[model samples]
Target: MTHVITYDIGTTGLKTCVFEITNQIQLIGSTTEGYDLKILENGGAEQDPNDWWNAMCLTTRRVLQENHLSPEDIQGISFCAQMQGLVLVDKHGEPIRKAMSYIDYRAKKEQKEGIGNGFKIGGANIVKLSKSLYITGAVSASVKDPVWKYKWVQQNEPENFHKVHKWLDVKEFLISKCTNKFVMTEDSAFATLLYDVRKGKKRFSREICQMFGVKMEHLPEIIRCTDMAGKLTEGAANELSLKEGVPVFGGGGDASLIGVGAGAVGPGSTHIYFGTSGWVSTVVKKRVLDINHMIASIIGANSGHFNYFAELETAGKCLEWVKDHLAMDESNLYLEKNQISEEKAVVYKNLYDYMMDAIAHVPAGSNGVIFTPWLHGNRCPFEDPNARGMFFNIGINSGKSDLIHAVLEGICYHFRWQLEAQEKKVNTSPVIRFVGGGALAPITCQILSNVLNRNIEVVEEPHNVGAVGAAVVTAVGLGLLSKIDDANQLIQVRDRYTPDPETKRTYDKYFPVFQSLYKNNKKAFEVLNSQ
Candidate 1:
């Protein structure tokens, strides 16, 4: 039986899985050790590219050893990685500096200025920083696309940037390590906010280039998701216990893979992922640009497929922050009782369970308390990076449970806002498929259903959907699957949840209050940030 090896390089760690292409049985598993996120003084989030490499190597070795399968048994390997990250490499394929993750906010001011009226560039241009010089004929104005955060490094840290030759995303960087080839898939490229989604081509926009001041040659070649970029090098194969010449297919951005894993390949299907962050995405047969520019549109994995991704900057992270700050004492007590020294895991879980049970007792809408789920900032519909989280209409009797419930309801209300915006552009409301770490929480899922008033289906193996999606793309690239749709037959949904009418009614009443809070507080938020 032919087998496909899939890897998902995420914000936290690297997950590697081996699967049979014919039966779709996941036979082997391993994960690389996670690396720590370095948060600098000025809101900088960075990680060493070498850490990603180590994780890939460690996981590949573990998967090979645990499965006890010969390298020849694996037919192909593909990857799905975190999006919108920047990595710089020298001519010899060496990293010039640490990778700046998508969450990094150091460029917030630059992003704001880039999208302003002077150049008439779209809001998407704000996310990337690339330089474009138009000295020659029809000189394409190349601004420093946000993908060139490394270029920013070059200007700011002359020593490190001087050593840089080619800059790549995490997906391309990892693949280059194994194959010694410089290649990045289209879906990943689009996330850098560099590629023109309308044209479906890989080239820097002249107007944007002039605005950002970034060079074009610094970017990697963007290939189709299923294209075989190169073969695994013999040295890499031996080190990871993989067969030489194993075809390495071009992998896609993690969101696209998640769409496939959530069985949202067909038009009209929507997938909502609540993990460390939350996103609501739908697959489109054609590119659906938001005239309002509230949502982010990007290329999808399947040929001719496009997708719209709407996000909540902090869905899971908000709860985490609350637990860390508000529930610290309670968490310490639990950790002491359980003999668990890790306050984060022990406290978060205990806090989450307590909050869930408490919220279950309160009526929907958290008894008139409204919350703004903008702990980080708003992404979808509003696209306000400077937005802040808030709780409105707090009563004198409000307690921990009420606050927790309001936060959950706030997140769901944000989902409602995104869905309303999407429904205006797309024809399908099709069911919302929930995936990721948050999907495992029954209360969270039910709360979401109540607020959205739609049936929510949860995939059984939520953790590896991205990996499976990568495997499917690899199979299609290798001619094992005729089309993207064919892979749908292999996907399975483990469970489903329907909305409760009573809860939905209560949430609907409170949603308007949630909207009003944002409207009233918008100018205040901007003023606070300005100070």
Candidate 2:
């Protein structure tokens, strides 16, 4: 068996995992380290690169020590990280400024000037949008897309922008730190919306760069996800207590790899991920863009494959908010570091478990209440930064449990909407794999299955699926695996959920109402949130 290390760089923290690759992939040890996401008052979300590095070093050491393994035991390393982040670096691979997160929407001014003005369709300039669609099969119309972030920095922070030698996404920055080689994976490159996706042209589009006022030279060399970037350098090696010559592969973004990890690498394979953010993605043979719905096909880790992705900005985050506010007393039972009494601890292992139990007693349809899961704005089927979450149709009879259940149902309802939009363009897998931290709850699995009226399969270690995808990349790079599709043989599904006829009927009734909530409130949202 060959051993490899993979990093899942999430929004709130970094997770490092050690995997044994043989006939199957086995997670040996895992560790996580948290960091701060600096939320600026002006809708800016940034993170210090140093914090990511520190978290990486800490987690690497802890996972290695806990597994009783040494540096020599690790054969390869790769990453699966959040995509569309703006990480500008200097010539020496140092960050020019705090990395702008995918959640950052401070680029509104830049977005308006770039694509939102003039004759428009779907809130974007018609001529520019048409060109973008024809060239890249996607458009950077969202205020949070990386192109706008790049322009935001160029116009607002000229000094830092001038110092930048290369532009990178989150994983590419870490790869540069490890290998001292400036490179980006194909998937990361495509997220920029500046990459040409034509059959014979798979490079950065000079035309698009010029159109957006971005320097073409700032883009780095793009490599396939399975290719080795370079060997780890002495500095990165010493910092992580690993060997200097360990091969580092070109890992991909979560959208690309999480599906690969879940055995959804083949065309038409579908997966739904509910994490801090959520997405409905399906592997497809050709690139596709639904400008009307804000869904697009993005480059995948596997060659010639693309993931038709539709995302919701806040998924489990809505649950986080509900736990903290609507269920404050219950959240204190397990979420806080404070010691829980033995009696209470025996009843519930964590806040999620407590919530699942509480909501299990609440009937489907959230007792006639519908909640929108757009706490931090929304994307997909509708691109409205002004949208906010609300508990609709709440009567005096509605209680805290009903509202909490509505939050979970709301997230599921949104995923179903994204899936329906995708079905309009391409065929998605009948039985979808459900992976992410949210899948740990059985109630969530059932609710999702019922809401979508499809089979939901949960694999072992659902939360680590992204790391598993990264491991598959490293294994392919090391020649332990012949291709990415072999990952299907390695991952084992832990549970299967099918829609309950009675529950499906209840959810079916509320799903239409949930869909109407956004359309009905669009004007109200814009009016109330106009800044």
Candidate 3:
């Protein structure tokens, strides 16, 4: 057996996991450290790179000590991180400014002037859109995309932009700190929508870069996800209480590897992830694009494959917002009560559990209430930064339980929307793997099953799927496994949920209204939020 450490870097926190990889992937120890994501005025989201490094150091020491293992025992290290973040680093690999979070949309003006204005189709300049699609199978159409972030910095923070030595994603920045090597895995490179996806041309496209006014020099060397980036350096080793020269694999973004952790690497294999953000992805043999719906196939960690992907900017984040605002009383219970036992004496661990327990008996459809889960805006099926979440059709009879249940159902409704959009182009697996922090709740699993009317499979340690996927990449890099496809044999499902026809009927009744909510309120959203 080989021991490895995988860091799953998320928007709000970092999760570190130690795994024993053999024929099966066993999680031995783990830790999570959170950092703040500063939400600036005008849709700017940022995080300090130093905060991430500190969290890594703190979690690394704790997990290693708790597991009674030394750094030398860890055969390799890897990362699966949030994608599309823009981290501009200087010659010394230090960040020139605060890293732009994936949700940052301050590039509205840049997007407008760059691509949103002029002769356009689907809100993008037709000429540029066609070129981008021809080369990359995607377009930098959203204000939140990395190229626009780079442009935002160039026009607004010209001094910082001049000092940038290379552009890196969240995982690439961490990889640089660990190994003193500046590189981006294929998956991260492709997310920029600047890389050429044509056969025998897996490199960054000079034409797309020039069209977008991006300096190719700022981009880092591209490497496959299964390649070794470099060895952990002495400075990083000392900070994390580890040995130097430990191989650091070129890990991928959550989009590419989370599905791998769910054993959804094969073509047509689908998985749904609900975390701070959520997405529906299916492995496909070739690239696919649906410009109308804003869904496209992105390069995955596996060679010659793409992930047909759709995203929801905020998924479990809506739950977080509910816990903060709507569930104030329940939040107090969370602090006052550490654990609660029921007839089964099941110890409730987190506030979500208590919240789920409180709403477990609430019927499907939230009793005629519908909710839109666009708290931070949306991506797939539509691209509207002005869109905001709301609880619709709430009557005087509606209770807190109804609203809370509606939030969960609202997210599931969006998932179904994305799933159907994907199905329009390609077939998806019937037994979809559900993995993420949200999947820990059985109620959520069942609600998702009912809403989508498909079997929902949950693996052990659903929250750590990203970390496990990173470990699988490391194992392949270290030659412990023959290929990534071996993950299907290692990660097994712990539970499978079948849809309840009666519950499905209730959800089916409301799903149409949920779909119409966006179209009905879009004008109102733009009018109110166009600031």
Model 3 per-residue lDDT tens digits across residues 353-406? 788989998899888888899987788889999999999988999998999999
Order of candidate numbers by TM-score, starting with the best = 3, 2, 1
Per-candidate Cα lDDT values, in order, are 0.73, 0.91, 0.92
Model 3 residue 322 distance off true place after TM-score fit, in angstroms: 1.0
Sorted by lDDT (best first), the order is 3, 2, 1
How close to the true structure is residue 373 of candidate 1, measured as C-alpha lDDT? 83
**Residues 321-358, candidate 2, lDDT per residue (tens digit)?**
88778776654665564345578779998877777787
Quote the lDDT for 331 in model 2.
Answer: 47
User: What are the per-residue Cα lDDT tens digits for candidate 1 across 1-531?
Assistant: 678788888877788888787756354564556776675655467889888888877888788778787778888999988877888898877788788876666665454444442534444332231232111111111122344354457556888876767778888898898889887787776666555543443554554545455666777777889899899999888777788999999978788888887778887789887766778898877666553535645678977777777767678777776666554555476666534346555655665665565467877777678878887556567655457898888889887678877777788888888888888888645578888767877888889888888888888677677887898888889888887778776777888889999878888788887878777888887777532
Lowest lDDT sum, 10 consecutive residues, model 1, at 133-142
C-alpha RMSD for every candidate: 4.8, 2.1, 2.1
> Which is superior by lDDT, 2 or 3?
3
Best by lDDT: 3
lDDT at 236 for candidate 3?
A: 95
